[model samples]
Target: MRRRRLPATALAVLALVTAGGCASSPPPPPPQTRAGHPERGAQLIAQYGCGSCHTIPGIDRADGLVGPPLTRFGARSYIAGKLPNSDDNLRRWISDPQAVVPGNAMPNLGIDQIDAQDIAAYLYTLD
Candidate 1:
């Protein structure tokens, strides 16, 4: 018996139809948090010099003994040993540590709301 093969163009069309007719990239990851960008948060962390007092896993020069290590900040359940480890509290701590916990070593970095949100988003990614 003799066999016949489909033409290249026909095979290409078949491939497309079999593969859902068109190619598309995957859906983007859901927003990490409301109005928060983890990538930007990382940069902001570095820019604000948070690494100078804490040991962050992904940022360079983030090793410091003054503050507790943040390698697993996402797993933590409290900020400054007082506030709940919720996103809001994290943002509050980042924006005004002194306000959250008076006489604490963590100083107020004057981080804006949006920046604080982004930083919180990044911190949550540690897990």
Candidate 2:
């Protein structure tokens, strides 16, 4: 018996369909306590020079590249690959990252409780 061959276009379409069938969507981002106050956090971030090590969002003047950016912190699964992502955790990280991660590059900025809370609040809104 003789076999027939599909046209090039038909074969291409089939390949695309097969590849698309195997595609999967990414997981959802982590939840936050409340909407972020990026504006307020922005101010604190600049005042504390957080941009020197870590990157934060909405602060155009920030150019530091030592640490990760705070653009999508609210949705991140972990703060330093060990600590869970949450309002409380974020506050802890902002105030003292070394304590949570141990030997982490982040330093203790001596951020007050209220300022840390505000920073966490702002980070949570990145999503």
Candidate 3:
């Protein structure tokens, strides 16, 4: 018994397919802001105990591994690996994690829209 070699054309097609499969999707747009207060957002983060789960920069005792580290969240292109990293998206995610990413480890802290915006504003400053 012996193995048969694939044709040159077959190998070329395979290579193209493999390359396409490995291609990464383009990143989302940069972060946007509207009616947000960074100072309030920072205060809210601590008030809500967000540091207990996320590693927020500039916030003392905000070193946790339960969630992704938010060292440069403002510079990121996406939120939860899907939604664009805009202020609106961040607000929505903060208000209700389940709605943004179902079954996500982040819980819905019952945060209102205003507080969410504040939080997003603070996160944008990390960049």
Best by lDDT: 3
lDDT for each candidate structure = 0.82, 0.74, 0.87
| Model 2 lDDT per residue over 1-127, tens place | 9999999999999999777652254334466245446568778888898777766677667667888777777677777766667677778778888788788788888997678887777777766
Which pairs clash in the backbone of model 1? Answer: none
Local error of candidate 1 at residue 124 (angstroms): 0.5
Candidate 3 residues lying further than 4 Å off, grouped into runs, are 1-25, 31-34
lDDT (Cα, tens digit) per residue for candidate 3, span 49-92: 99999999889899989999999888887888878778778889
> Candidate 2 regions off by >4 Å?
1-32, 35-38
Global fold similarity of model 1 (TM-score)? 0.71
TM per candidate: 0.71, 0.68, 0.78
Better candidate number, 1 or 2, judged by lDDT: 1
Worst 10 residues of 1 by lDDT: 21-30
State which candidate, 2 or 3, has the greater lDDT: 3
lDDT of 1 by residue, 29-116 (tens): 3334545899999999999998999999898898888999998888766677676677778888889888877898988877999999
* Deviation of model 3 at 99, angstroms: 0.9
For model 3, what is the alpha-carbon lDDT of residue 54? 90
Candidate 3 Cα RMSD (Å): 5.4
